[model samples]
Target chain A: MSNKTITIDDIEVPFEEGQTIMDAALAAEIYIPHLCHKPGLSPHGSCKLCTVDVDGRAVSACTLPAAEGQRIDNNTPALNEVRKTITQMLFIEGNHLCPSCEKSGDCTLQAMAYHLGMLDGHFPQFYPQRELDASHPTLVLDRDRCILCELCVRASREYDGKDVFAISGRNTNRQLIVNSATGRLADSDIETDDMAAHICPVGAILIKDHGYEIPIGRRTFDLHSVAESDLGEIKLSNVRHHDE
Target chain B: MSKLRVGTTSLAGCFGCHMSFLDMDERIVGLLEHIEFTRSPINDIKHCEPCDIGLIEGGLCNADNVHVLQEFRENCKILIAVGACAINGGVPAMRNHFTLKQCLEEAFIDGIGVDNPHIPNDVEIPLLLSKVHPIHEVVKVDYYLPGCPPPADAFVKILTDLLEGREPSLPNEMLHYD
Candidate 1:
């Protein structure tokens, strides 16, 4: 392990060479709220949720390399307020009806909103009309809840070895599209067990028959905050046991 | 101590939120000691009188809803948007995805079971807005309590805090969208 260290909110965190600031923070069991970033997948800084102040400059922590003596601010009221607004934008941009949504308790977007203490969608809701694809035998893709995180896009290409999904268009017109000739998931190369099928951070992609199986209040985020639940899992499986 | 006047009304919402407010149950008897019902379903009051606090459930879907919400805003010193509908338009706002004409046609003309297939056009009926909107869009809301129907404890917390002259804030556990 490289001896290089950086200060996150004045706490010394060591990093290995080539490790991004996010990698270092996660390894140190520090939770930096993120949506588009998943470890082991090439970082796509689309969600902008993992933005941290690096040496007084705002940068995506997942892509920014950890340099020695770098002063980073991860958890601050000002930064959290910005993150809250970003989460709100994500909410308003989509028709995320959490009460009716199957992914309400398990959704990272909702968990992030809870973590940020977001009371309401602070801005005017765009309420853009989007489509829902139920053509797949075991999976459903509801674009109404998509936040353009690209996790499914990356997971399909890198992990599942099937580039079944890709984003099309640009700006407000941008949308998730299937790679199949019919422009449907059923016609695509994706399978029920594919990483891309299960990689959506929000309710955008969901399993067909397995929704609302776990009762409310017993689901993932209900048991613990996203920070505690995700970081604890990471600590248990990867960081502490592997380090030991 | 003079009892604080409280008003409540439900617009384009399922009365679930109002039911939850009543779910305060016996504690409501204790609440009555501090607050008096001014214009609420509990008292079967129609027009709102001047009140210390107004708890509004549901979103603005029609002209009547807008008028009632504006009256609440005008009469109440503090207006709290309660539950999912009042905060972010909730299930009622689902209609926002389609045009008002489409919704009316679907409900009246184009529906599978329709004995009388015509849009209801009556002088008594309030005109539907083009889009359903959260209460905050039509009027300034002092506080927002979010949930499908925020738990009874949440209502207690907000009311107790306001009654004590404190800023209304739900605990992390009490703060949920669904």
Candidate 2:
């Protein structure tokens, strides 16, 4: 560990020389709400859920490098309110019917909303007519629930070494597209065991025949809040990796 | 103090929230000590009277639902949008992505095993809205209880808090979307 340190919400947090604010904060066991970020993946600050105030400037924590003596505000009420609104935007932007969704209890987006105490979708629902890709033999892509986090896009490209997914279009017209000739997941080279198959933070991409396997009350976010559960999973995975 | 008058209704919902409300079971005997039911299915009341609290389940999908919600909002001092449907246009809102004409066609004419193949457009039938809307979209909602059907303890907790003249706040455990 380097001697360099930064203060998040006035609490001293040590960081290595090259670590981003999110990296340093997570290492220090501080919970900063995020949706598009995963530890090993390259930071894509598209979601803006992890926006934090650094010396009165709001910036995405995942992309911002940690500097010495920086005063960063991670969990302020005003910032949380902004985050809540962003989460609501994500909800209304897509058809996130949490009650009927198979990913309800285990979805990061839903968990994040609950963690933020979001009671309703504050904006009008766009209710966009998106297509569902059930063409895959053992996987399904429901665009209705996608938040466009690009986690699967990064995971497939970086870890799986297959650029099977990419986002197409601009702004509201933007959509996730497949890399195959037919523009369907079944036509792509993706498999059930691929990192992209399991990397979605929302219910957009899901494995077939395994939905609702975990009972409602016993599911991931049901047992623990998103903050605790997400951090705990990361830490636990880190411990397992070290043992290996 | 007089018993607080309360009304409950289900529009396009399955009444699962009401089932969860009744899941309070014997505790409702305790609740009855403080509140009385009006314009609810429990009493088969057709119209809402002026009340202290009104708990509405389901979203507005038809003209009748809209009219009922507006009336319900008018009669209650504090209106609580109960369950996911009432709060965010839950499962029924899935139809929102398709045109009402397509939906009607699919359900009545195009769908398999439909012996009678015509969309209902009788005078007795309420007009279907182009989109399903959460209660708040149609009327002012004082509070929201979110869940597919919110848990029984959540209902009890919100009601208890409101009864004690406190702002209703649910614990993290009680707050869930499913």
lDDT of 1 by residue, A123-205 (tens): 77787888779999888999988998898999889888989898999899889999999999899989877778776879999
DockQ of 2: 0.84
**Model 2, TM vs. native:** 0.96
Model 1 alpha-carbon miss at residue A154, Å? 0.1
lDDT of 2 by residue, A1-244 (tens): 6899999988999999889999998888899999998898899999999999999899999999999999999898999999999999999999889888888888899999999999999788888888899999999999878888998899899889999999999989899999999999999999887788888888899888888677887888888888986677563133111012
Q: TM-score, each model?
A: 0.95, 0.96
- Poorest 10 consecutive residues by lDDT, candidate 1 chain A: A235-244
Top candidate (DockQ):
2
Model 2 chain A — which ten-residue stretch has the worst lDDT?
A: A235-244
TM-score of chain A of 1: 0.94
Those runs of model 2 whose alpha carbons end farther than 4 Å from true positions after fitting are A235-244
